[model samples]
Target: MRELPYDRLKAYEGQPVATAGAGKDLVNEPMIRHWCEAMGDANPAYRGPDAIAPPTMLQAWTMGGLSGHTDRSGAYDELFGLLDGAGYTSVVATDCEQEYPRPLRPGDRITFDAVIESVSERKTTKLGTGHFITTRMEVRADGEPAGTHRFRILKYAPAARMTKAPERTAAAGETEAAEETEAAERSKAPGQPEARRPRPVINRDNAGFWAGVETHRLLIQVCGGCGTPRFPWLPGCRGCGSPEWHTVEATGAGTVYSYVVMHHPPFPAFDPPYAVALIELAEGVRMVSNVIGVPYDKVRIGMPVQLEFLRVDGEWELPVFRAGGGVAG
Candidate 1:
């Protein structure tokens, strides 16, 4: 491995990266609707005559789109070039956090200024050895303070590929004995404990949804004011801005609205090449969950599926959709 220029990277920290970068479009209904649909956010406050953009969509309004931003400072580009020159050429977004002071409304022009928040020392991770670079942007709505978005990305050289060992053939008697042991394990008592998988981050807004999952029921939130049903429950209705809402049990019947086959960066808790789907339930709401009971390549949009409570581990149960009547082991 080549030595990374840690001092040069750390020196760029706290520098201004972009100034007065503007969003391509003013806050408008069309873009808001598209965002809400894609996110499956059905807050009444995001619709109707008086609607506010989803607070989590703070960074969306500041996106430069395909043509890129003209106001981006050379420092930002230089920082990336330095990393690339150091052989940390690949980049992947790790996560982002945002805080919104006020909701964005239609006709509000969006502008932002960003700074290189911090550059971490070179660290080793599952993806590879890399530096984590963070940027913080202050977003304004028509010159008024609206929100702040902090984004982080990992810049790293690709991990060395693992070489597979040659397979060894076993004798007939040894193979039979191995098969017998496997069968015995499978036929063991169902009460045996299993390894626990990662748990979901449950917060005040989505605790109820997880509680419902524990009981093997799929619940969708319904606004009391406009009677709009929504998935991935929100505190208020996006269509009517109603704070009061109740839950309705989903029929567990849905169709795949969109999907992606995950094949890279395998995790310990999950196998790669699995299908993750955005399912549109019969209740007119959509939610993201794994689509099991079929091969990853077979999961297509509009495929009919039924809800199944999947026991991911001994302690956690998640709601995953099973394609057709086939069940996942």
Candidate 2:
């Protein structure tokens, strides 16, 4: 394989990638509601007469959507062409950071400009060998600076795909010898445990949510001030900013609103090609969890699912959605 031209790639740093890019729509309530519904964020502050969009939704206002923006400069395209020519055809967003200087209210006209901030030297990662490209955008609301967004993505050739070894039938005599060897190995290393799944980080805001999972109950937070319910528990109502809240048990009924099948970069303690779904509960909030009792390919939008507790390992139990009563083969 030809080596990546790192010095040539880095030469595009500090160039203008996008300028005078205007949003397709002004900040509005409908988009805000959709984002909140998809994220299971029911902060009361996002609703009602005096409301502002979520701070995290800063980039949403600037997206060009399916048609893309005409204001994008050729420098960005040329940089990507250089990487693709070197066989780094695959790309994945690595991280993003946003800072809000003012709230984005409804009816605010959004515009932005971006610069190619930097490019990193080629590095090997678990996913593959890649270079990280960073971009910084200055967002404006009604021609005044509102926030800054910094995004980074890794462009790389995908790692070689892994294949399973073919199975071979063992002769009767060979099977006996293999059984004896396995018994001896087990005796030598008793109870070899598998790696644990990554644990959820519990903080004061969402600690109660995990505690409820421990007892096999799904809890949603209800705000005391506005009487609104939210999932993935928050400390205060996003709508009213009231800190007082109570818990409500979920009814365990929902439908698959959207889903994705994970099939790459398999991890220990997890089987690949499993379906992770965004479930829209009957209570009008959405949360992400795994879908079981059905093949990953069979899970579809609007599929009925019931909440169920799954004991992943001895130490962990999680809430997962089951497609039906019977398990899929």
Among these predicted structures, which one has the highest TM-score?
1
Give candidate 1's error at residue 132 in angstroms.
Answer: 2.7
| Candidate 2 local lDDT, 101-137, one digit each (tens) | 9999999999999999999999876456888999999
Assess every candidate by TM-score.
0.72, 0.67
**What is candidate 2's local distance difference test score?**
0.79
lDDT of 1 by residue, 229-290 (tens): 98778898767778999999988988898999888864434445568898888888888987
Highest lDDT, which number? 2
For candidate 1, give the lDDT.
0.77
Give the 10-residue window scoring lowest on summed lDDT in candidate 2: 180-189
lDDT of each: 0.77, 0.79
Error of 2 at 20 (Å): 3.0
